[model samples]
Target: MSKDKKRADLDEKFQQLRSMTNSTSANKASILVKASNHIRKLKDKIEKLNQELGSTSTYPNTENEHQQDSFPKVNVETLENMFTVNVESEQNCPGLLLTIIQVFEELGLDVLNAEAACNDGFELAAQGVWNEGAESLDAEIVKQVVIEAIRKWMSGTASP
Candidate 1:
């Protein structure tokens, strides 16, 4: 591309970044600095959240904490038409496993092998193949659908 065109593209990207980061700077350098600072703050927030999860719970809101503890960590990996999925959580809800399986079925995914443990905590690892009918599936799409299913399940179980 030409110099002016390249510069314009860069400027447009910087503007987009500024909007995303909620920075109100007109200068490129200022926008960049603000974006960097914004990223640092987000990292700090995530670190603080991790620390809270690691620490003990002594608060009176045990019910709220219990709900948070049920949120599962989901991972998915794709290789060609095959996907490897793992879901783990500190606490197991009764129907969570079924909910996840429903997502795979809805997406026309066939489970080749799987394991599940729900005695102490909930954990599942499965390898599946995408059937020919539905569009090709990727890791993120599979993970997201499973998460949404879990979220709906949790919401229904939450206390009013």
Candidate 2:
């Protein structure tokens, strides 16, 4: 079927399902029964179409994984200072603390103080240290790098 026709058919089926689901207080059991049956039939037909056209290719088509790589854009600012980050991960992942250390190393940043605890969830407390001769390094740059590195590590891409 043409794309337009397929979309229209899907829309019609969705409308039918919605109307059936919304039919309440009919004062008759038969109306509810009929609506339920119609909805079931529509669902079965949708499932069949999904199987035939392939779930990933048909309706509810989602973006490709490669297209969704960039996320949580970093905000850049002009300043020089040092800061700390405390990371907590609710998901059960082993050595989540080590992952943060790896990110700092990969980013070419010095970790002044670092500690981790991973009983309920992974928690990483870290202070990014910077010393540039007599003057300190840009604080904003340090903050941005540390924040970006933590975000990247969480998203499975810690390498720069």
Candidate 3:
């Protein structure tokens, strides 16, 4: 099928899904399951379309793609023996915060506090403490590693 036709069909299906989701005639569980299945089908169709178009990026590019940088802001601060990491992103990329937490865990750091929020964008902040006698837990190194990991993830080059 042509891309335009496929997109139009997908849009029509989405509208049907939205109507079903808002309908009061059916049981909520059944409606939810139907909606979920529709979403999965839509995702699969989108991926197929992307492949047909020879696009390598996982997410579709928005207009003005060159005008905005999607790279999230990452900041690391050290106070005494504690390290605080803050991340802000223009979009709510799924699993970003969890990946950051995993980075700390993989580095043998104890996360004392962690929080994430999303409105129009995503924000994650975490505080961690190193073990009393642990070596190679430098704040700068940890910060760099986290930054690199997030960059790789954003670029769709990270391992799943």
Model 1: lDDT of residue 19: 73
TM-score of 2: 0.35
Candidate 3 per-residue lDDT, tens place, 7-123, comes to 989767666655744444345466667778756764665555445445444233445655246767777887646888898888878877777877777666788888889877889
Instruction: Report the lDDT of model 2 for residue 103.
Output: 48
Error of 1 at 100 (Å): 0.8
Model 2 CA lDDT for position 108:
49
Give the Cα error of residue 54 in candidate 2, in Å. 30
Kindly report which residue stretches of model 2 are placed more than 4 angstroms away from their true locations once superposed: 1-81, 131-160
Please give the lDDT score at residue 76 for candidate 2: 27
Report the lDDT of model 1 for residue 7.
97
For candidate 1, list the clashing residue pairs, or say none: none
lDDT of 2 at 19: 51
lDDT of 2 by residue, 5-112 (tens): 999897676555445445444344655576677657656654554454343221122276442332222222222334465655554446445655664554445677
Q: In candidate 3, which residue pairs clash? A: none
Higher-scoring candidate on lDDT, 2 or 3: 3
Q: State model 2's lDDT.
A: 0.50
Top of the candidates by TM-score: 1
lDDT of each: 0.73, 0.50, 0.67
lDDT per residue (tens digit) for residues 1-160 in model 1: 9999999999899988787666787888998988898678756654553363343221212267666665788899987568999999888667888888887887788999999999988999999887864434557656666666676677784222
